[model samples]
Target: MTPGLPMPVPAPGLPARVRIHEVGARDGLQNEQTVIPTEIKAEFVRRLAAAGLDTVEATSFVHPKWVPQLADAERLFPAVRDLAPEVRLPVLVPNERGLDRALTLGADRIAVFGSATESFAKANLNRTVDEALATFAPVVARAKEAGAHVRGYLSMCFGDPWEGPVPVPQVVRVCRALLDQGCDELSLGDTIGVATPGHVTALLTALNEAGVPTDVLGVHFHDTYGQALANTLAALQHGVTTVDASTGGLGGCPYAKSATGNLATEDLVWMLRGLGIETGVDLERLTATSVWMAERLGRPSPSRTVRALSASLGSPDSLDSHKE
Candidate 1:
């Protein structure tokens, strides 16, 4: 166990055990300009699982033309599928074809992406919001029928880069649509990382009123505005237990140039441990994994926790070399 930071008492209604969904291999690497080797991607997943992450998103089954970096999803899945029986490897499937490929690979867990605003929906999926949801409905149905757990991700929930502020009701409708499609959980995303703690509280409160269960809701925030951790803390206070984070703070939205990486897993673990929340993640191993990944990316980790620990542990080479 890593030494806990001195934290104030956790806010009321926070869950004792939070599930940290590691998304570095899939969501993190997809936006990279340079294509990472398949073997190294596989090793990255292996290292994440070894760091005690129970739910590590392995890869995406989207078309290679859209995300060339993850073109090797077919090969990557099998390589990391058997890393651990308890570790879940959920791949992102954009449509029926993606689902078909994932099913053929014996994937038992998968995720679908949706956007809250029309501009992003069309830009990302080349369809309107309703059309995109319609497309995901069948994919979710097929995955569920095949005994695979399906997670839905709604991007730009807080604000859209193209359309400006996204209304809460609009987000709620999409959330309801995904649940109605039989998704097991929904990961609300701050695609542009423009969300603050207030926005998180408001959106989650609206979802709760709309009958969306917090148990099946996860929060995916970007650190572009450096609010990911604060927003995560707010989500926890509202009874959300699952969180999506990337090791080494990898990933950005290809469509949204201003968007940065997802919240760093090491940073989230540091705060959760300090708050006495059990995540079943080993901070030391997780930090080391981020450093190892940074070396492979030819850049240092964007995680403060990783940098601080690496420096204190006498590995200054792991500090981020790239400017924010």
Candidate 2:
């Protein structure tokens, strides 16, 4: 662990194995200014899976006007169609149109985005909170009926950029709507990274009280305020076994300038290893992959673990030094 970082306490109820849902390919690259080639994007997903990320979010089917970086989703998905059977590729479907695109491409796993606050719902999806849930209702149902596993993403669950602190009850209601709509799992997103450990506990407690199973919950946090890993530990203590992280902390919210990037996979792996949590991700290979991808992005990774490991190995190019 890095010096001065808080040690993760081993809570009794914590799960033995945690599933790290790699979102670097989709969430991480969506905000990039440069247009990455479709082949490169496909290769990035392959390398992430090679680093032992079993579940990788491939790309979003949203319109090019909304997220142009992921416009090549149609071309990208087919490039990775033959990956190992254990590797599950999920694509983001913003609406019914996006869901239609994903289904046409034969995506077995799809995700929909929703918001807990009215402000974010309006800004992000141009709908009210209730309206956004209503939009996702049939989308989730139709996807589930097609034998596709649907994952629901509730953004701004903890704090919204426009609306200050979001109430736990509001988040629970949206969560229930998604789950009741046939979403197999729900990922609570700290969109602006304003969540703290106490807030995480409070939200999870309320969700549990509302009868939302922890086993079907995942936590997605941004490292904007640098509280993501700490907040993740709180969620795990509360029995959340699934986490969402970007490979090199690659992407941030284009809507929120203050939002930096998603929690770094290497950083999360560092903490999970210290806590003796099994993520099935190889830390060394993960760091190397992030560094390699960072080079392609023409920038250094935002992950402390990636930077530290790169320095320890005497340069980013020396990625093979740590290979077994």
Candidate 3:
């Protein structure tokens, strides 16, 4: 215990609790060329829950024309409704229509996405940033009435594809607006993976100045330039807790050209454990599951740690690079 501070009461073995909202079933599977069957989606959710992820973004309740893959979200939601009672399965609602669908499916938690860049907003949401927020107001109000938890996503918080560097002021404005309107938590997304540790601190600092509580903020970063984990650590130091990570580094924003996969769960777990942060994740199990997922996707695993560990499994020398 630190000097002058009471020691924390120790239990037999208290698990370190960290909130990981898995987006693999929705964010990961959405962009694939092949339409993953609904059964597969449910099984994927079950597996993720079994792996000890307490929160999972199960699917997006959007129009079939917009995201044909998740069109059967209603069916998928019910299939996995029997998940361990402790796990939360939040779905994404793009608008009032989607929110209604989520409500119909008995969704108790939902997430909404807003953009920080006008150009990216125009391209993806077909509206200005303000317009997109306005479009979600009714959805937010309805969600609150239904007693559901709402997580807001602010995309392109660090950089924009068309506009390049996004002003910190702009990010703060959007984040404040989302909280003011009503969102339990706001996840600031480095949609393009261009954020540095400095940028992360600056943005969070600005948000703090704007009266948004740090605990209500979460970090969602991509590893396109190998900075996602770095940025995540910076955010943690900045007093921001709760992070968004995909299992096995499963997905990236398809609309953001330079964007790559999310910070690998295994990689994030490794860092958190090193810091003694207690993410409550089973690293060995998570890594093995990631390997199984990589095989299913038929692609090279995006996680460096996963690759190194896989090679280590084949030969002891392969583990040298990861040794402390």
Candidate 4:
């Protein structure tokens, strides 16, 4: 720690207020091979809401054939619908079919994903990038008519598994399209977790120059390469305030081979606190919850900071023993 340097300085140009949309219940559990009981999912949603997360992605309305893990989204939604009326329970809607399912379940906030990489788009959605975006127009319009807020996700913005380096123009074009399609906000996903700080700067700069306003952009990063926090700092410097992270670093891309985990929520909160940003997340509570989840899964946490902090918390006290 630097002398006289107060921890948690707010990033420049970032709004004094920032929103963190918790994805642990949905994105976090979607990748788990074990079928989390619907009750467990509901309980997790309750805990997350109680932990001061105003936005929690409760579940995805995708078909079981495509994502069997979230097959119980319909069962999960109504169970936790009234957890906190102020807390937004956004659900992922893949296409018109998924949209219909969400609407049937009375979804209020919806998210749709598109890919900046052509190869990832075909592999993940079985369509070209443009074709995938085209499918969302009707879905977005319908959701809007039904008084739902729409959020757009642009995946593989940093690099692609099959295509390698994704061009800046490609990312900007996808972002613009999503914004133009009536999405209230757009999230740029580093799906492969291959983004460096320089890559983050260049991408956000290009997107801004292309007229994608900073207020409407969010950053979703994976910690596969352990660079998520750093990349997030770059995004914050670029004036992006909203970020997506999993509770225990629990999610990964199914179509992205060899990818690891989503950025840990505990680590993001820790970094934000250290930088003087107010995430309004209870770090102690989040850290304990993360430790509990990691134990439940029988896997070590993917967050280096969380692991270190947990180790220290469990260590013997040095209060009276420090004299030696």
Candidate 5:
């Protein structure tokens, strides 16, 4: 057994493997007020891929006016795209124009962000819920026609700041619409991080009962209330195989004021490794990657696993050269 890794406990009823959909590059950096250089962002994607995170969200094609941080999507995409086929580098496409931009850049995995409530729709996309769905419809269709894997992200699945706890049925409706619109899978977002274990299970049950298959669902939890891992355990219990995480808990909802950092990838890997679930992630290397990133951002990593491992390893002297 590795020094920092856990003993293999092999939890029963959990899947033998879970795919960690890494979002540290795009979703992680999108909300940054300080614009990181395009090369640095590209290098971040490369380092993440080198750390054994096979599915990394590279960047978004959302207009620069909306998200200045990701305005370099075109340059960043090409820089890390060669890692694709081996690594699934998914990009966020905001609308048809965004889709066109991504398609031209050879982005084979594309994601569309949607809101489960009206207020967020207005705030984020400047449209109503249905209007946002309608906009995504053509993008999904075109992506499918282009032989791309489409992931639909439904935000505010648990609770909304302006509208309190959201109904499961409302989320299910939007999820069904996205799937119907040709999304290969759906990622349910706990945007406000207000979900408990019971709420997590209940919503998964509701979506399943509404004819959504478990195999095609993913969970994206925020750690605002420190319930992310607990909520993730609930998700895993429900047979969810796809988990979205940001390295070092690097992101938040820029549009949603009350939202916080995403569930940290290093933390998730530690917990999953303890359970003996195969994620094909190297905890040591991933921790180093996080530490390097933390230094680049001039702060300590928020991920407990990263902090613990860094301390145990006596501060990774270098993250400058990530092994290929």
Candidate 6:
């Protein structure tokens, strides 16, 4: 038995398929009050992979002091590191030491987090925007040297709480700097969840004008103002194929209290399926994973799709086949 799917209606000017960059394990759970067990995190990764997420960002290699929730990065990566070769399990690395730890664990898919604005850079990394980029330079270099694919994450690209509306040129400059530093691709983060469709298009246009091809760009939006999916569609219209999301709508930035959860993977899948934009995700299987995770987290999932399916299907037993 499967959950209901939207009627497929092909959209013009969109990619035939999009690579959903699942960030639930790292970005989703980082702000939780309680720490999720290592085994549970591993199981989540397994379930997501089984549900057909090609790239599941596994965990972060930052100091435990900064994010105690994912302190088990050392333990968690190994547990899920042996997933199918086609499945890409990327991990976030904060600096050279973090990169060292990830490389030691055979994590070839690495992402370095940065900020497009000075305020967020200071608040999140305690460095200016330039300082943060400078810090990431060596990490990106070493990872690339080791034949690892590097993704650069620039947060607060659309808007910043302290700085207000971020200029398009400012974001374009930082994006170029990251690519120039040898990043394989870039994910523009609407960290505070304030971006609208116009702002999203503007950034993509500016980046393209700056020579950052749409193919090397990914969009990471939050649903704070109910604009994540809209912003995603704008990026899609611009020819971006990599979209970042968390399962079950499970996370928010610990630094930006106003920031809500990452774009829910289940929600993204539903829209993609409806638009006839393939994402290779099994919505029922993905929803089951969310249900299972919700039970573990002791809270109901915030994803509209997950909630609806779980309510209509009304049986956890039915979702078991998809669970890992």
Query: What is the C-alpha local distance difference test score of candidate 6?
Result: 0.90
Q: How many residue pairs clash in each candidate at the backbone level?
A: 0, 0, 0, 5, 0, 0
Residue pairs whose backbone atoms clash in candidate 6 = none
Give the lDDT ranking, best first: 6, 1, 5, 2, 4, 3
Model 1 lDDT on a 0 to 1 scale: 0.89
Once fitted onto the true fold, the runs of candidate 3 whose alpha carbons sit more than 4 angstroms away are: 1-17, 252-259, 312-324
In model 6, the Cα lDDT at residue 176 comes to 95
Which one wins on lDDT?
6
The 0-to-1 C-alpha lDDT of every candidate, in the order given, reads 0.89, 0.88, 0.80, 0.82, 0.89, 0.90
Superior candidate under TM-score, 2 versus 6? 6
User: In lDDT terms, how accurate is model 5?
Assistant: 0.89
lDDT of 4 by residue, 1-28 (tens): 1132137666567556568988888888
lDDT of 6 at 26: 90
Pairs in clash, predicted candidate 2: none
lDDT of 6 by residue, 204-317 (tens): 988888898999999999888778998898889889999999998889645444344689899899999999998889999999999999889877777778877876667452
RMSD of 1: 3.2
Residue 284 of model 3 has an lDDT of 64
Q: State which candidate, 4 or 5, has the greater TM-score.
A: 5
TM-scores for all candidates? 0.93, 0.92, 0.88, 0.90, 0.94, 0.94
Better of 3 and 4 by lDDT: 4
| Regions of candidate 4 where Cα sits further than 4 Å from its true position | 1-6, 9-15, 253-260, 312-324
RMSD, one per candidate, in order: 3.2, 4.0, 6.1, 4.2, 4.4, 4.1
Please state the error at residue 252 of candidate 3 in Å: 4.4
Between candidates 1 and 5, the TM-score winner: 5
Q: How many backbone clashes can be found in candidate 1?
A: 0
The lDDT of model 2 is: 0.88
Q: Residue by residue across 1-324, what tens digits does model 5's lDDT show?
A: 127578889878998899999998988888778889998888888888888888999999999999999988888888888864689999999999999999999999999999999989999889999999999989999999999999999999999989999998999999999999999999999998899999999999998899999999999999988899999999999999999999888885444442447999999998998999999888888888888777777667767777677877778533233333
Q: After superposition, how far is residue 307 of candidate 3 from its true place, in Å?
A: 1.7
Worst 10 residues of 5 by lDDT: 315-324
